[model samples]
Target: MEQIQEAYDALAIEFAASNPKSKAAYDIATKCLPGGNTRTVLFYEPFPLYTERAEGCHLWDVDGHKYVDLLGEYTAGLYGHSNPVILKAIQEALKRGLSFGSHHADEARLAQLIRDRFSGIELVRFTNSGTEATLMALAAAKIFTDRSKIMVFEGGYHGGGFLFKSGPHPVNVPHQFLMAQYNDTASVDELIAANGEDIAAIIVEPMIGSGGCIPGTPGFLAHLREKATEIGAVLIFDEVMTSRLYSGGGVQSELGITPDLTTLGKYIGGGMSFGAFGGKADIMSTYDPRATSTARKGASVPHAGTFNNNVLTMAAGSAGLENVFSPDVARTLHGRGDDLRNKLNSIAKGTILKVTGCGSIMNIRFIATPPEDIHNVRDLEGQSTLLLDMLHLYMLGQGFYMARRGFIALSLELTATELDGFLEAAQGFLRKYATLVSG
Candidate 1:
């Protein structure tokens, strides 16, 4: 451990020396923005890189250091920086108009694409981001079920306001939330037995993102579907990051478990800000002002967002789905991720490093004797956080960019050569730090 700290200190000094321009940028930005950052995840100790430009899957920092970008903008950059197809679509939409302040043809087309893709989505509504989509999905669930309590798992992150890494975040919306253990059916069963009557919904990610990229077991997720139905609670699958895993239908479709509600964001809008929540016709009808059925009750749910149907997002999303990111492309990217992850695991076999994830998104952890399969964040209790930092700095020094938290989300634009280069660099890192990482 002492040796690991020493190596990390040396790497940090090297990183600081190499990124003086980013340091200067941080120094200047701190005066205006708190912590010199807007996104919480982008901030890291010793500051973060300020990229001057990006193209395809590569980024050039302010100091002219080039990097193969595996961060993929936290899964929102699946189309990669400057995808020509998405750019052309956005450009065409701009030529037409920006703020129509009303409905357009592209809106319905995008909604139809989403509905046809996700089997669970009978009807859909758009939002500006995944955060809004999750929030609105919860609201719809509560309204439909007429219940007060929401069941969520530890380590589940729906969005910024719905974080549950360890416990309810202070900024989280004040919903009556019931906590449960992830990938543990019995934990959910216990929660249902006690609070079944008051539970409105059970929201979960088929594979939890931003909480260590832990994939929920098939049995566990299936059990969530069964219990939610047995207790008359709505089941919501948050597929913000996982939607890209299995073409259109997501992991839920792959697992043959359909949720009552599904929330989507990231990549779906062709690298633009976008989100959507959809589900059974009955539940989604709550927002239909013109609905004559009892599904709407008496009043329609007021969901108002100016950019919900923004022309640019609708156009870009439609273009990407219809022309660029086809189902075959999705499958190829997923397979590539599986191959990359397997190679990474092979490289770390004799070390305290382990990788966990599904499809194109993954996380790296430095835990002595990591479980053959990580079920939840608790399973990673003694993971070396410092070692993860050391690995991040080392990778940066080698002209590879990944999330400081060890997250990696591959983009569609990355080539075999770029991935191979990253792997070679990773092998070099292992060789250089063999002493520090040895089990």
Candidate 2:
């Protein structure tokens, strides 16, 4: 353990020295930006690498070092960086206009595209971020049901909204949100039975994203849907990260469990910031301005944003969906993810490291058996964060980028040769780290 930590420390020093410009930038950023970074996702120990530019599946850092991108901006770049299709669309949209407070044709076009793919979505509303989309979904559910409480899975991250973040302290939450176990129907039943009447909805990520790339069991999801229907609570599927797993947003095509509402983002934005929520016609009609005149909030549910359907994002999103919707393209991306998972598992077969996930998302666990089957956030208690961090640093030093939480998202641009390189590098790292586990 000590040796591994020392090796990582040395690598950190080398990383810092190799990128003088990024190091200087980090130092300057610390003066104004807390933690020397604007977003928590970009903060890496010993400072993060500053990218000069990215093309296809590769990223060139400020130091001129190139690496095959596996992080994909936390799974937001499924089509890869600077994709020609997406780029051309964005350029065209820019020529027309950037933002229009009024509704644009592209917004409806994108919404129609999404609706066509996911069966549960009858009407869609756009938001600037997944966080806002989720917040709006929750608010709409509450208003429609006249219920204040919501049920959320422990590891499920809908967004950074106060309601979603209401767990153990430091989140400073003030709402009626209940935390339930993931993949355990009994736990959800318990919560619903205790507070079903007051609960407006149950929101969950079909595949846990930031909590680790764990997928919800089919049985568990079915149970959740049944319970939600029985109790008259909305079932919200947050497919922001898992949308890349299938052509049709995750739950619809992958799990086949339909929800009352679905929130989407990540790759749908085509490397831009965009999010959306939609649901059944009757439920979604609660927000229709034309229908609800003279009622409570004067129709429309008071959900509006200046940049809700920015032209650039809409164009990029449409182009991104074009790539994802192609059967061959979706198969290729999913194949790469499968190859990665299999290769990692083969490497760690007899070792302490355990690889777990589904389709295009995966995680590495230091323990032999991941606690609680990793169905939810509470199951993360036994995970080896220190060991994972060391392994992450090791991988970064060897020229691979991964989410700090060990999530790896593959892109359509990567070829077999690039994929093999990642597997080989990861095998080498695991072999080296196995010595520490044995000691």
Q: Tell me the lDDT of model 2 at 213.
A: 74
| Candidate 1 structure quality by residue, lDDT tens digits, 38-137 | 9999899888889999999899999999999999988889999988999999999999998899989999999999987887889999999999999999
Cα lDDT tens digits, model 2, 31-136, are: 9988887777777777787888999999988778888888877777888887888999999998887777777888888898888778778899889888888888
Angstrom error at residue 330, model 2 = 1.6
Show where candidate 2 strays beyond 4 Å. 162-169, 292-298, 370-372
Best by TM-score: 1
The TM-score, computed over Cα atoms with residue i paired to residue i, of candidate 1 is 0.98
Assess the local accuracy of residue 197 in candidate 1 as a C-alpha lDDT between 0 and 100.
Answer: 93
| Collision pairs in model 2 | 155-377
State the lDDT at 2 in candidate 1.
89
lDDT of each: 0.91, 0.77
The CA lDDT at 328 in model 2 is 61
